[model samples]
Target: MAGIDNIMAAIPGGSTRRFYGTAHWDGARWWAKLGDGPNNLLDAWWQDPVQPLQGGKIAVDITKDEYGQAASFVIGGYTDQPRPSSGTVQEIIPAGVATQIVIMGEDAVAYTTDRFIGEYSPGDPVYLTWDAAKPTVIGKIGASAPPPTPDAPVLVPTNPPGSETLIATASDTYWAPGGWGSYSTSRNGGEDIYTGTWYGNTVTGAWFYGAQRPALQGKTISRIRFRLPARIRGAGNYNDIAIVHFYAHTSGARPGGDVARVTGPHDIPVPPGFAGGDVDLPLSFAPALVAGGGISIAGNPYTGFNSRLKDANSGRLIIDWSS
Candidate 1:
């Protein structure tokens, strides 16, 4: 169902308007406080806290005039009131069968593509009726509708499972092993970074990304593992290692700790070199698997001297650290 806005009371005029704490049908006229204190009129639906009538419901001798129409009611109802967007709504329906859907907008109970009868506009008073198959042009709202396209799969950390810690100078690469290609982190591509302050058991200065910020900042990461993809050689592409490089510092700003340098090739080293041999580079990340500054790919070191690594085949540098 989309939503439930306001419910307008359908009351009749001329009747003595009286606030009723709790009105019960007494054969003839529904009796209650005829005005004199706080319990003078029916409470607002949104204000009321009670279960509504159900199938084959009925309301008799209800005031049908203009003035004494609206009565007490609540805002959301149907399933446990405050409905969940990913929840399901099941009604006996004139046909019968539970149809699940994701509600989108307000007045959701009034909309149902199938077996749609009529809709209850916002602010409509609750009217009791005992006709499960009432043939009326109205139907209760279903669950919220789903989006048109498939949603991107959420990125759930498999390795470290929490914050990752790396020495300011170390070039350690944390890769999620076991061929997990389906998952992707919200922390993809380049993002802004923030540093933390360490105190006691906690060492401050943990860098963070803006878009996909870590669950907590400055969290002492026990350990981290990068989930890497198993690269397959294309037609002409050889089974060579793709070298990854690491930089001690991205910009001129270096965070306190001394830079831990990686003295190795940026790209994954090929056994027989890049001479197109049967021997494979075997994409291994053994070198920079410890607390260090940052890991990068490429043989040629840029401005600030730091750690560098590369893929043996593609040579495309992959960042395998939690900054």
Candidate 2:
């Protein structure tokens, strides 16, 4: 097993179930063995809506068979999906002192966690966040990076507000080459254009670029805007504009339910050369997000515009909402 299952789960039959190990292609479909166990409480079953990528870790769900031993386990989600959380504040930076944190190899800002608690003195769990990356901090936290159950992690708000902003920099990007397990990368490294099948000869398809919006229970989004930095489009994809789609994100940040996408300065028009200045992509969609429900975004890889949008945390997926 590449990684052991941290969460425990229960099956109807009786035996405890597991859902981690090296995910592999079994000729027919992809699967990872539930680590040897007597576990029952379904550990970390974040309703992932997609398949595992090669070399990526896997989460499993028992299907059809009785609850005890389960007839079969199906790949439920890619572990390491949520933006890695840096447990506890290593040190507290005042309101706007500008800070940085390294998560899963990406440099995340310390201010991203929603309304840091007044009593948060360092050692406490600072991993709570509305989304993964970006500058500003908002309100409420969704799921833990890993280990925590599907129930969204909650923090006592310092002075709770009716509004919160989920920045794009606070997002997580995962990649998979072959058909094994998926791994996460900091949004620090700009995400790629949605190419669906980024693999060439051996590997086939699987690249999810997205951010997990915080569980803003009882509130609704007031405005949703994507700030895209200057970018250059190529002839490969007919220089078409990138279109982003939103979906219900499983707890682990997996591309669940429907396919998704990502990238920086994603939808601005560019000439053959580097487009100057940042531009906001205008989207016309209902801000009908369920109060406090976890949501996600995915890139439309069919466009084949695999160019890199290499801006720092400046380019973001800004979501503003009120209760």
Candidate 3:
């Protein structure tokens, strides 16, 4: 599933809106006032807070409809954070620790940083995720943050056990030649990269040039994602498609070995108007596929061409380096 901000951005009509507030308990009812300063501190709503009020000051997000009706709420989250991007760790709690670090310009602890904030020299840049009154840091600027659990369900297995996920787009994507040869010699080269196999209705086994992305140059891939718009080849026929092969090539120019594969009629009864979602295929390379940094990928369908991944660069690959 897409994040809240991502979802909101996708919505064309702005019927619903969100507001930030500072929560409080007015004797009995849990209430929150706008964070826009004392002069404009309007009580947005009086709803149950999301988390235990560890500290007296708790940040909250109120979700309301156009008519000022708050439907839900979020606590100590990104919606109320003072800093939206990277900030310097001005002061650590125990002089060197990052449990609670203050931003360079702030008078209070900006975030309850990650345990693996990585040896910061008191004033290192770090990303953060607000989790109530305690915002969590993303780690040192150089290291990637581990989103162990996916924000929401995309395809199969709501939350892949893997800690890190990197989305990479396919580069040099095109239809493989009648004869599998060099990538440059394809019919549609140097264009938007696309992937997936096509076991044609005709006896021609013309697969995609292969799903290769430059962003995923030399990393070890542990999972791959593809959009499955279950629109079959011909309306009358029941294509018992089995395996969707996921290929990644770290050595050669084209996709070589299988990075992952899933076999099933997962979307059997293709709905009325071709409605289907994403699916995450898991990868398994024995003996720990420890390459330099990242891994590139490519793949084709088992039967008919049935992948709906085409957004200039929307292909996604997950690496087990835990990001």
Scored by lDDT, the top model is: 3
Q: Per-residue alpha-carbon lDDT of model 3 for 1-323, expressed as tens digits?
A: 33334433443331334444456555666554543333433343222325434224544433333333333333333333355556677766777544556664243444444443446667777766544445556566677666768677657754434433433333333333432222321224432322344343211111222333443444445554544434333322222222333333332233353222222212322222233455554454211222211222233332332222433223333434222
lDDT of 2 by residue, 1-323 (tens): 22232232233332334445544555676545444443322322232334455445555543322322223343344434354444445554453452432112123433433344334444344344332132222212343345656787777875344544443322333444421123212224434333223333111112222443455544555655544333224312322233434343323233432223222222423322224343333323213223222333344433222222354433344555454
- Can you give the TM-score per candidate against the true fold? 0.18, 0.28, 0.28
* Alpha-carbon lDDT of model 1: 0.26
- Positional deviation of 219 in candidate 2, in angstroms? 1.5
> How many clashes (backbone N, Cα, C below 3 Å) per candidate?
96, 46, 12
Q: Which ten residues in a row have the lowest lDDT in candidate 2?
A: 200-209
* Ranked by lDDT, top first: 3, 2, 1
Off by over 4 Å in 3: 1-83, 96-99, 104-109, 114-116, 129-134, 139-222, 229-262, 265-278, 282-323
Off by over 4 Å in 2: 1-162, 169-190, 196-215, 229-235, 238-248, 251-309
User: Model 2, residue 259: what's the lDDT?
Assistant: 25
Go through the candidates in order and give each one's C-alpha lDDT: 0.26, 0.36, 0.38
Which runs in model 1 stand beyond 4 Å of their true positions? 1-164, 170-287, 291-294, 299-323
lDDT of 1 by residue, 1-323 (tens): 11111112423342222222333333554333222343343333221233333221222122223333333322222232332222123333333342322222233453332323334433333222212222122334352456756787867775453333222222221122311111122023211111111121111111211121233343333333322222222201122223333232232123334223444332322210122222112223223332222323332211111111221221112233342
